[model samples]
Target: MDISMGDEPRRLTSCWLYWIAVPTGDQAGVMATLGLTQPTPVTFAEAETIIDEDGHGEAEGNPDGLSRVYVSPEVDGWTLVIGWWCDPCDGERDDEVLRRVTELSARYGRAQAYYYGAQGDGSAWLIAERGAVLRRYCATGEAEDDLFTLGEPLPLERARRNELGLSSSWGKAVGNDEGGSEWKSAAFHLAPKIAAALGISPLALTAETRVRGTGVLALTPQGAEAEPVT
Candidate 1:
């Protein structure tokens, strides 16, 4: 059965979520590259349920609290790996997450990860190419500096800034008039658009989306080698 995209493109969920999109339909290769194992076939809806229900739950296999990702096959030449543990905004794990995403890009040529938290109204995105991260941005909708930023602003980001009458250059003062939670909130909404522009956005998946093969549930590396309890 095919799932409808509906009007869910802008909202990840009621809380938080993270997903990685790569430009390839090689499901097996993607799982292997991510060090994921124990694949279980599942429908797109079931996959979403698994991720949503177990995203923050502790499981026997995941003793380290790593993410158990749902690996979608090919959706318009891109595969999405959904799991909360893949979050890029985690301060402590941000570096490791970026490293893994960069490595994934190295193998696949291009990869992107997105994070959104409804509670804080935070959104983040990272785009990597050939093992190097080209751009990364985060906004928490708080009265603080940008959480994290790197490389140059993406064309969409530049255009957005221009539309909002903000500075095109990063770190450049855009005056208090143009600086407020509006821009940060805008970032939250922009994450999905960026995903749509670059590849497939999880929220954009629908019956109309080109899907090849089925999704699979896989254990993260932390749980891949765990021994079953006696």
Candidate 2:
């Protein structure tokens, strides 16, 4: 069953997953870029159902790590890749995730990844263009040293820093003990908003969204095997 949005609009939350957006309608390119194997055609509705079921560990034959994903067709000039494989909460896998996102941006001119965790425990976002990640931020509410962050903060993040009375330079503020804690706390909820401003928020997909083709379910390289959960 579809999760209820209540009076508020649908927002990407829980079932912790990563969303990758690229400005193109080429679903094949997206699938190939992610190295996804075993293409299986599915409509948007079916894709959503699969994702929901997998999130609940109730999907038929759902693997331990759900090495499967839903790739949406072009919607309003953007294509979205949804999966848990790219989640940024793992400090050990941070470089690997960034490498994948950079590869996508290198091929598509620009790519963005966003993560929203269950119960607001963590959140992250990365924006890359022309083979370079311009900004990356992650706050997993884990060890302080494990807070993976890189590049400069985006404009929206800068504005938020100002609102929080942080220094103009994000690096400098993060260098401060107090500022770092405050920013991390605030960043825990910034993924969804940053995603909306930079490209598309997962929940922003609506009946009004311009859709060019159907979504599809694809397998990761390991097929039904599990990827380590952070």
The global C-alpha lDDT for each of the candidates, from Candidate 1 onward, is 0.72, 0.71
lDDT for each residue of candidate 1 in 1-230, tens digit (9 for 90 to 100): 23344412122232566888999989898887778888877766566656556555544554334647778877888888888667776677788779888988999999998987656566788999999999887776544325457778899988987888877665611123445545665666777789889888887776567767777778787655566311
lDDT per residue for candidate 2 within 1-230, as digits (tens), equals 12222211123333666778888998898888878877776766566666666656665555444477777767778888777666654566668778888998999899988887657666788889999989877667665533566787688887987999977574523334458878877777888888788788777777667666766788877654554221
RMSD of each: 4.5, 5.1
Range of the 10 consecutive residues with the lowest summed lDDT in candidate 1: 5-14
What does candidate 1 score on TM?
A: 0.82
TM-score of each: 0.82, 0.83
